[model samples]
Target: MTEEEKKTADTGQQEEAKKPETSAEGTKEQKEEKASADTKPETEKKADGKEEAAAADASAKDDKKASFFKKNDKKEKELQDKIDALNDQLRRQMAEFDNYRKRTDREKEQMFSNGEANVIEKILPVVDNFERGFDTVQDEDKDDAFVKGMQKIYSQLQKELTDLGVKPIDCVGKPFDPSFHNAVQQVEDDTKESGTVAVELQKGYMYHDKVIRHSMVAVVS
Candidate 1:
């Protein structure tokens, strides 16, 4: 062979070997790019999952807080209702006690007034006998020592009865009242008006403003 032709063939053979190495390097770069793409997607998915879990936990905590507040409010309402019921019961009991006290006081006062009236009614007969004994005395015996002593004793008794709120009812020269006077007989009298008391047959007595004994009288008609 010629030297120029051999040199040209050798240069062509070397260029063919360099073409295989270049192809291998291009294949390696394509594999590395594919692996980087797959890893990037997995990393983003993990970060998103962690963020979602955090949000769900925060929502659960908020729900628990709201439930706790609701329970507390219900318990407070129940306690307030119980307090109001107790206060109403206490007021009712106090009112009942006050009414009972007033009733007992009225009963005691009525009983005491009835007892006093009964005693005054029994003593009125003795006062009438004393006045009759004094009326039977004569004018000649009026200056006797025994009669004077009896007069003094009768005057003292009358003073004591007056001090105890006892007084004689006036029946003569006054209009006849059915409330204070009882007529035994009707009489015709020229000096007195009709339907009036002409004479007091028996004395009547009063205790304070109440008539203990009615006046026995003769009416002028």
Candidate 2:
């Protein structure tokens, strides 16, 4: 009803409208802050996931590299083993070949020696006939030029045989040996010991230290 009372009522009404606007502004700021906080947790979770994925990828790559190296090492070892085995086999084959060569050489030498001995044995009979024919010649024939020439030839042949590692074995007046002498007759002799060779009917010959012929002898018993 009064002017003062009417002015107070208008001021009170203006204050009531300002209070509601302030409260609305504070509620909007609170909502904006809550939204910001929620977005921060999502962004941090995404970053952590990326880091975990990168670390897993790096570990997988490292594992693959290790596996590759291991496989290469195994293959190298196998190849080395094969090389060693081949080397051992080659050595064994070479040794076998060497032994075979040595054996062949020995056999060839033995065969040559045997052949030489056999030829010498066959020629010895001709020498014996020459000596026998000379013994049958008359004493007058010894002065003949033809007889002397025959004696020279026989002496030359004997010298050639001596130079060829051939020698005559002496059996008479020595003890009889079955290995060197073949007894053709037995005689009773008081001068020589028993089982002694009294006479040599055929001369024995040796070639290169091996007997080519045994002596035919008469034994004294």
Alpha carbon deviation, residue 23, candidate 1 (Å):
16
Best by lDDT: 2
What are the lDDT scores of the predictions, listed in order? 0.89, 0.93
For model 1, residues 1-221, the per-residue Cα lDDT tens digits are 89999999999999999998989998888889999998999999999999899999999999999999999999999999999999999999999999999998998976876677678778777777877887999999999998899888888888987987889999997889999999998999999899989999998888888888899999998
Give per-residue lDDT, candidate 2, residue 89.
Answer: 100
What ranges in model 2 sit over 4 Å off?
A: 1-62, 138-140
When superposed on Cα atoms, how far off is each prediction in RMSD?
A: 5.8, 5.4
Task: Summarize candidate 2's per-residue lDDT along 38-151 as a digit string, tens digits.
Answer: 999999999999999999999999999999999999999999999999999999999999999999999998899899888878889999999998999999889999988989
The residue pairs found clashing in candidate 1 are none
